[model samples]
Target chain A: MAQTLILEGNEGYVLSEILKLSDAQHPTGYLSNEEYTKYFLKSVKGVSNVRKTLAQQINDPTITNVGIIVDANSKGTKARFDSIKSTLTQYLPTVENWDYVASSPAGWVADVAPSFRVGLWVMPNNKDDGYFEHFLTELIAPEDESFLAAQEMLTSIQKSKNQRFPDLRAQKALLALFLAIQEEPGMSAVTALRKGLLRHKHPAARLFVDWYENTFTLG
Target chain B: MIEHLTIKNFLAFPELEVPELKLINLVAGKNGVGKTALLEAIQLYKCSDKIGTNRLISENRKGNIIHHKDRIFASKLEINNLSMTMAVGDYKSKVFIDGEQVEGHGHPDDYPNHEYEFIRSGIKEHDWISRRWSSFVLTEKEELVTEVISKVIGLNIFRIAVTDQSIMVKIAGAKNPVNIKSLGDGLMRTFQIAMALVDSKPLASNLIGLLLIDEIETHLHHSVIRKLWKIIFEYAIKWNIQVVATTHSQDAIRQLFYEAAANESYQEKVQVLRLQIGRSGKHEVIEYPYEKLEFMMDTKLEIRGL
Candidate 1:
């Protein structure tokens, strides 16, 4: 529980993403059987019952117990970290802290709201255990030619950048260089993630993880 | 060519669905058994948009929206032999066109999409009603009277409701000097009828066209009624316009059948529907052969309400 995990912060961001995604009425809200049938079954009748279930799930105690704590200015783990320690004291029965989950103030309200929050479920390409990922990619990827091209450009650059370092050092070096290149003006979003990986130098890597965590933990 | 129409969705009678009709249709009901309602629904279906117009100013207004809703039935008016399969809101209602199913839209909006196109005889629909209207009375504001025959031939006309009986349809032109009240009520009614005929000149939708007149013998002497019937019958025959009017006057009915029986042209063309709506809330539109409707008044027919 005391151990620090590098990907844990990204996992927090994904959780936040999952909550936001679930916020819309489509996936998890008042989808009555009769309404669903009328919408899809071609029958003429009123539907009820689904709206309340979704409301209850959103109001449930489990997620309420899983509170999040975010620290804005850390000064490399100084009073900011102490503030986190202080906040964690009051948020009990919620795992003593977000030990099992990730923390970031970003998207806090969206994650807490019922029937609407649908956040990060799984990591992209990493296939990591996390929030569910059912976003625009499923529908747009099949038809969007531009998105396919951009995806190709990003992976190609990531590959070329990876080859610049030895195989053993490549994983760490790649992200650090990609992060730096991403900071350039008018940078492609795909390149930004790759360049963000460039900050994989131990200190910057720690920071990259923190940035990802804040995105999900802080609202 | 619907001879009769009957509907029963009133609180007095919950389940009565027979619209007994033949070549000559008649509706007879006391005070109110949804008699006028049945008539209005048919009118709404046929000409809802024409409920307003400037063309009928010299005549009389129609297009009256009358309603007395009950908690039981939403709207219960039995349609007979509707050819169009109307799609209203959520239901696909069937229509019998001379005992045959009409393919495509039954709803008025979908009328244009139906395969059956009602192409008029070399007359642009726009100018058709207007052309016919040219022959009608168009009085100027200064009370001058002139023929509107050319103006009404090809133009879309107007609609009328029961409440519209008092309003002016065809009016004096801007320069005319005749005051509308100066004319007798019978004259005003005649002007309304003429305007309506022009309004309904097959220039628009081609569904069944019926000119409904309630108490046609209104505000006129027996002689005037006879004269009016002759003119109405002639107009109905010439334009293929169907007339389904209600009247309590035997003198009026007798004169009509007498004229038709004596003349070959009036024999099969002129019709009368005997209408009777009872406390049961159901209406009966007994189609009379020739003008037997004129003789039904003497018959010992016992209608619950009437």
Candidate 2:
């Protein structure tokens, strides 16, 4: 049976983008009408803003989590987060909110299963994708400036290079960056290097699994 | 209130140690060298006690602190004056607090952090005294007040920021605003420090509290940094609050010492500890006299910062 989830966020595109990176059997899904009413419309932001329809696909019940990506720019984001958590706290077989926003920090919504809620400030959406290039060109690919530029365009959109996002929170971001590279021709030179770790196999995925087992204690 | 911090092998810089520190300790290091990691360690150190060592070990072992494999185990964390020392590793962990054992994890208040404990605490103490001493982390500038400032500092703050969103409580020129997030980072941080001073003391009494900021200077012009120093020093004298913070900005480093020398109270009480990533990836801390930092900032030697 396929698990399902209802994602909550301000940007549908970012939520959808994160769904693409999840790489779970049926782990990708969006909010249904019931969840939209319970999670979004009833919330304070929904009460204030227009109710725009979002288009994201839900595959099967295997999708156990939902990403709740938001930008730091939201006016009452803190309050809104509380609202989301509270709304879902009551659901039977509840789902967690995941994140896929750029420049934001990664957090888990374990009610369903662990996921991230990425944002701009947490990640620092500077230059959209420049830091990856900076890290690649300067740190990873020092000699080749142009090639680094390509990676910057294809790199994971996390926040400041100065700040570190725990390895546990990096699963979606790293997976997304990999998929983005596969879609673009600019990063072919670096593809061979990355392919050393098979994409479908997800060697990088272990970092997060280790995190869940270590950090989150059993109730 | 937090007396001291101690860290043991978790990731990088095994056996990293420090004595009881002053109000403001300036930590500087090369990029990817662990400046912010030190702050995270401190937050984890103190917060672990409040939350649980299980979360602490897991949070670290998850490989988020060092960005390496999650196998950086075999570690212990403790804060002096407070009893618990968190021993972290794979399969087994323990948190000994005040001579008793405890379980749980994450920020001391709540795992999954149900609510913003900092702001909730700020709101509880939002009466008269807290208005004077103001302190904050200046990442999103004005929004610091909205998102964190208003919460930790209180709703009465002239500013409030949520995530990246910030709005100043006071609109134009007014006596004071409800939220402080509307202003720039420098002004807002000063406001938090000032408010904290006032709230923690009686009028005209010197407040003996610490101000710890990750980056001492954020988004302020050099001249403005000087003015902020003047304002904070005056507040400290009037209210009797000790200021402790961190900064990588040369402008902030210079202004703090310059203002300290010009003001006697600061000269007597102020201390600046410089943290550097030494040759072996270990942290080397050097305490600089006001005059020494002044000279270095003037020379403008390129020093890599976290």
Candidate 3:
């Protein structure tokens, strides 16, 4: 059976778009015939919810492998990794060995052992403290000057407001505003990506896409 | 309490090993899927000495007990302080404790046919059932008997005594005192379980090692079974006892899930093993956790097979 993929929060939209784009680019049967090679994606409300489900998932024999996606906001990559590590170890003591993959400037993926190869990706990349928006910001397609002007305008607005909004939230708000300015307007990240408005082919986004494909691809 | 159990060449099971057995385990499966055989094997290992081989063979239907491919049938159970092994075949039914031979395979005439009183099943005679109630009344353990009776049977067994010919008992709703035999099978089943569980100085404490029942939902309503289960669960935890019972009723399992959901720990303690015949004509055991079972129950899946 195909292994289960767990994502933190309601990140299903972004994940589904990524999987759709990857399948179109790499024509793999893993996502279609789930019993043999397809990956099943599931998202819990938050990290604590993931902890609870992960505790039970480790004991479930049918679930061969697990993939987790979380934001490494504020708490650095190691702290984010330890949050899941403690829960996994408490439930399954046999878990050992860790391979940290440096996928991007803000993404970090760890391959943990003991049969269930748990892969963790902390956004925006492996070395920094940021959320999904921080990673999504890197996929703004460098040549889009209108989005650049929109980012500057939002930055000036935050400055005028005495920087009350957090840096991550400020950037996310700018991104959301820019997405709303699109031809369709108010479309989610996934829908925008499908409409060819979001740069799913950007190198920064491709790093995450490749990491996801490689981690879940069956031998 | 039995912490682990393994059976080989026993009925439909050629080799079966239940490694992570909890205190309150429920065996569920389709008909002729070896659910009863599993309980029978456990009883043979623990309570067989009480009822001799002849009675056991007759009631347990040991003629077809062995697997078709294997001649030697064996079972191993790990109890609180003892490890027991039982092997039955043409050589004879032999029982060993801690690797030391305790009983021979042949049926002995003089050997006490029955000893400990707690082991009882729907197919077994009630005369050999636990005499805990009689002992309770005889020794003035009325408080314990009445307390357990009301909790398990939902009827106040205020009066109980041994007559010259039989045992008489009176329930709160009944018109008058009647023979315990006249109370009906459901009441009888409840009484046996309650008597074995209720703490009384007259009965042996260690006899509460294992509670094995085939089709535990027999002769009982879903609500009554749930109530009985609540009492059994409390007593089982208090006495550190392990319960392994089989049931084919979805109502029985619905009540169980309702109970487990109430007490969170009970969910972990309850292991539902569903046995099904695989394509190879061998029995396959599928274990469902409480959460998974609840999902199935909610989705109205057919958990009970044919």
> Highest lDDT, which number?
3
lDDT of 3 by residue, A37-156 (tens): 223555666677667656545644445566778877788888777788888677664556653444444343344544456767787776688778877767777677758877887878
* Residue B274 of model 1, lDDT score: 43
- Give the per-residue lDDT of model 3 (tens digit) for B1-306: 355556665555666766556777788776666787777666556444534444555654535433334444433222223333433222344565434444334222212222223333463344544354455665545666567667767777877765556667777777988887787777767766666555312134433345665677877777789987887677677655667778887777777777888898788888777666542345656677787777555433335353
Q: Over the stretch A17-131, how does candidate 2's per-residue lDDT look in tens digits?
A: 2223443222212135343333222111332111111101011112223333332232334444444444444322344443333322233334333332211111112212222
Q: TM-scores of all models? A: 0.35, 0.36, 0.56
lDDT ranking, best first: 3, 2, 1
State which candidate, 1 or 3, has the greater DockQ: 3
Better of 2 and 3 by DockQ: 3
Model 1, span A1-219: residue lDDT tens: 000111212233332232333331211211453332222111111111112112221222222212222212112222333333333333222312222233422222223222122222122211222111211122222344444554555457667754454443333333333333433634432343233321123332333234334322222
Kindly list the per-residue Cα lDDT of model 2 for residues B1-306, writing each as its tens digit: 233445554345454555545443455443444555566554454443545545554544343435323334233433322332332221123455545543323232222221111110122223322321233334333343333333333233444322323333543345755444344554455445444433333322321433334454555567766766675566545544434455666556667777887776566455555565432234555455555454444433222233
For candidate 1 chain B, the 10 contiguous residues with the lowest summed lDDT are: B114-123
- Report RMSD for candidate 3: 9.7
How well does each candidate reproduce the native contacts, as fnat?
Answer: 0.00, 0.00, 0.00
Lowest summed lDDT across 10 adjacent residues in model 3 chain A is found at A27-36
* B39-73: candidate 1 lDDT, tens digit per residue: 44344344323321122222222333224334333
User: What local lDDT does model 2 show for residue A71?
Assistant: 28
Task: Quickly count the clashes in candidate 1.
Answer: 116
- Model 2 earns a TM-score of 0.36
